[model samples]
Target: MSSFFGAFRRRLLTPPVSETTMEVRGFHVKNAEAKQRLEYIGEVFLKGYAYAVEAGSPAEAEELLETVPRDMRGFAYEGAGMGAAVYDSLPGHGGRLQGLLAGRGRDHDYMIYVGIGWAMARLPKPLWPDIRSTDPLLRWLALDGYGFHQAYFKTAAYVRTPHVQHPFRWRGGHNHYTANAIDQGIGRALWFVGGTDPDVVTDLIRAYPEHRHSDLYAGAGLACAYAGSVGEDELARFVEGAGEHRWALAQGSAFATEARIKAGTVIDHTHLAARVVCGTTAEGAAQVCRDTRPRTPEAAGPFPAYEAWRHDIAAQLASSSLVSKGADQ
Candidate 1:
């Protein structure tokens, strides 16, 4: 009874933040997803890297990573690359390639490295939060246009294109953000099969750069198809191919076009939350193995939950977005 009264009182005191204001406020707040994902990755550094490396090798690691449930594969990739300086094979979210080109000059190494940073930042976190309409103004503020743009800037850097300067120069970067959104929306299922610390890839997918975004998901599907029974090196090659394939797409692609493609790949809320929890757990475990104790009970808790959360969130977002579009039509 007292708790109910307290809740009612708090609701009565809350004020609204206009959508326009939320757009403004969004630009100012540092992206929570970006910060959280990076910290978690930092925690799981060795194990994550080892897993990533194995996934890339023609050995056991690839099989382990590949065997993760289809819905969870994308999320698992995020956990592995959280601490990595370069991150590739993230196609489902958008903004990565575009963000890379815009943030880093056209220099291949610089741009790819920037993309790697973005991949590390975006994969585990959702671009959008699950804010109920009934929530307070502050929460809604996080969903406004300006807020969205600011969040975009978290894992990305802006460039002085002909029509734009920063995130706010247009509607969430305008055509730049939109073009890539399709690729981002679809690439969620793929994995980065190879590359160094941050950047990774797969060669089979690389053969057709023009189809990089659309076809990348095929790699994930392929990985899922043969994950358990495959050898370590074969699995690694497939995973590595995912990254290598993306790198191929990045090169020779126009600056603006690539940015659009990359930008489209940002993850949504469920994956973001799951990765944070998983990453923190992985990092803690690694710390213990390296330092205090060898086997801690708390170490393994984050993995399954991370997988489940990612699967559920991805499914929900996909379905909701589809339904919303149909309703609008």
Candidate 2:
């Protein structure tokens, strides 16, 4: 059943290439072009990963990384995450990528670390056993992930915190924070770190004293829901750990679940993730997400359906909580 769903998901997310363009959310690109771009990015990631696996030291990997085009470095960073994930299956690659990342300064190259964080979040739990350790690079990536979440979501609580300076800018003059890459990276990093222990979420909240507690919790919540390994018991611990910030985490999880549903990446785990974050049954969350999904052509932005789904869920969660409590009482 898992294999079937996996095949189905791949088919849905990666349709056959064609001359005509396809639109998802709002961006439109030729099918072939999109596939080619992703392939190129994937190739870059493999090259970096291979280099890290065989090279004399982390320095060599960094050198090879520099050769990649600056514009594509973010994607390359993401690829490095993939490489790290792949390298995990082999011996001695445990901290190779992390070592390489440690050499890069976070002030200017934060997004690159964000890319790596995103990949780490998405990879399996065993890939990085020391994720919970106070490794400076891991800590920086996790904190930056939270910071990125605050900047991108623009949650009221985080408005006062200074925004991280992103080196890359979108074509439409939007800041790097506005790009989906940042969001993905941050959310995934949370999951990666959170997978180590829900308590890590609390530790991260404390680690970044300047940022809003709510924003940090939200990132952790998204990570818990999307972490893939978190179960009902672990989810409960995360919810408890979040304390006053549970609602923020719920919103983040709901948003992440909705994004997965919108992309037709629904799997058994998707249902579990929705259940954990919303305190609602998986079916209930899926219905809400499906009902709120934006129709094609009507969905005009990079994330119209995603935006709509989150809005609907947020409003519903807000309004229904009182009613649910009343009924329970």
Candidate 3:
């Protein structure tokens, strides 16, 4: 099919798959299981990318994306979103990402937002397609996606040396939540970069300022929810080790739950991660995210609506934890 060659050409526009491995990146591995798990995530994303690029239309791509294993389907959609963005960014091409977003892609909007960030990382700002119509609240996820790309591909600058700088302040120069969103993404990458070992991931987060621990832990918690590399017992241990940031971790887990539920990609592991990391069932944790989510069209704050939503969720979890502690006492 002509689509196959198109997909191949688009893929050629990016780095090869092997470059994503820990060995290729000279990063440490927690264990074989962790490496295998993260690598699978990449493979799924690439499959989605290929499908989107190869398809004649978004509807065709959706059919292909739906064929991915149920457990990893969301990642494929994320990849498809990334692929669309890359195509749209081409000098002669445009509207592919916009078309996907407006079509069946709406079901997986959150991932697409993050996926677009991946394209943003690879392409110049001028070349970036106009996606201003994206929700004001969720748009920050593009930065989160960008952060993950940087940390995943440029480990030296984002992880080990860590000298990332934001392009500008947000909310009319009132806050730098953009950087926070990106750090949250970096935190997610830390999950992969640290080989899914809780100790190594926590240590890497600890190396940052105490203030950033919450966002970092939040990202890590989301990654844990996505195709978890470990089981409930280990995830429970992660909760225990989270210390003061437990609420933030739970909040991130809850966000992941909401995203999966919205995309209709919820799996058994999604429930397990929600229960262990969030101290609630997947539906319950998702409800917490929903309840804390701002209702207004705009969230007014020193923080953006997205970060504000994050703060509220963490607060809700912190409050629930306090109540549970009191009952136990």
Candidate 4:
């Protein structure tokens, strides 16, 4: 009965599934495969989200999410993160999100944090402070999630309008780097927005101010690796298109490989992107991510820890002997 009540409440609160469709969103259609794959991600994500909201415990949610095929299981966890965030924001609920991060959900930590950002787009502004994370470095992923939501849902303002949202005074006034984090999310969404067309996606990014290109390219590289809808050739072409920003692209690819590997969700697509973008195997690229990560992120830089960490990864990727090895192949 308690489970039933929780789920009932969620059903009323959840966004309609159609909202994720390209047709509903008026997004580009690159191919039937990309179309179906994108829609399927949305369906699976909502399923995970609903389960997280309805399940009696985070463990129960994990059990149900694990039932999703291994390739997509992390996405379910990502959705569950969004669900947990939204659930915790409700009047009767509190601390479930913190509990989620503390328990079995820890493995999919990156996705979960990104999911919490999705909840930021849905919930009232007053409740924003309650959405918390134990890891300072990863808390920015919430902004990434927020950017994805705005781009995915509010296409006119965020994507087509080419209007980047103003940096909010979020996460206890970490104002300086907030927009950069949001731009990363926007870049990821462009992969979907252009139907994974390297030409179209590159053009879209080119439209943005030159200063924003690096973060956007990195975000695109992460999506190209993680939620792939393109082939090896397309991946290489995106690298070529990125030009001076290729290092940032590799950095983003490494980040995706690291996230997928950490969540135990590495797949063929993950390997493909890592190889093309980072010029290394998934494991190798993930290692690069770990190798360059800021051990003490809070004190790591004049540019802030997260940005500094990303720059270090990009520098390593750009200088590595492996750079362009796979792209040449």
Give, for candidate 4, the lowest lDDT window spanning 10 residues: 164-173
Q: Write the per-residue lDDT of candidate 2 for residues 1-329, one digit (tens) a residue.
A: 12453334324322132311122111122245433453454455444544444444556656766676654444344445434433444554466555655764221133334434433434454543343343322233433443443432342333223244234332222232233334433434444333335665465455544344555565556555543454567677777777766666676677556544543334565677676667675556655656654554134444434344445665676556668778999
The Cα error of candidate 2 at residue 77, in Å, is 16
Which ranges of candidate 4 are over 4 A from the true structure? 129-133, 163-165, 300-302, 322-329
TM-score for candidate 4, residues paired by index: 0.94
Q: Tell me the lDDT of model 1 at 279.
A: 18
Give the candidate number with the greatest TM-score: 4
Instruction: Return the TM-score for each candidate structure.
Output: 0.20, 0.43, 0.91, 0.94
Model 1: weakest 10-residue lDDT segment is 189-198
Clashing pairs in 2: 26-301
Give Cα distance to truth, residue 317, candidate 3, Å. 1.9
Per-residue lDDT tens digits of candidate 1, residues 1-329?
12453234324321222322314223221244433333332233233333432233223333443454433333333333321222223233323223322322222221222223333233343432122321121111111212222223331321111122232212221233322322221221122122111122232223333443432333232222212222334334433444424221211111112222232321232222112211112222122222321122122442322122223333333344366568889
Once fitted onto the true fold, the runs of candidate 1 whose alpha carbons sit more than 4 angstroms away are 1-38, 41-50, 54-59, 63-74, 78-156, 159-178, 182-329
Cα lDDT of model 1 overall? 0.27
Error of 3 at 146 (Å): 0.4
Q: Report how far residue 228 has shifted in candidate 3, in Å.
A: 0.8
lDDT of 4 at 68: 93
Poorest 10 consecutive residues of model 2 by lDDT?
19-28
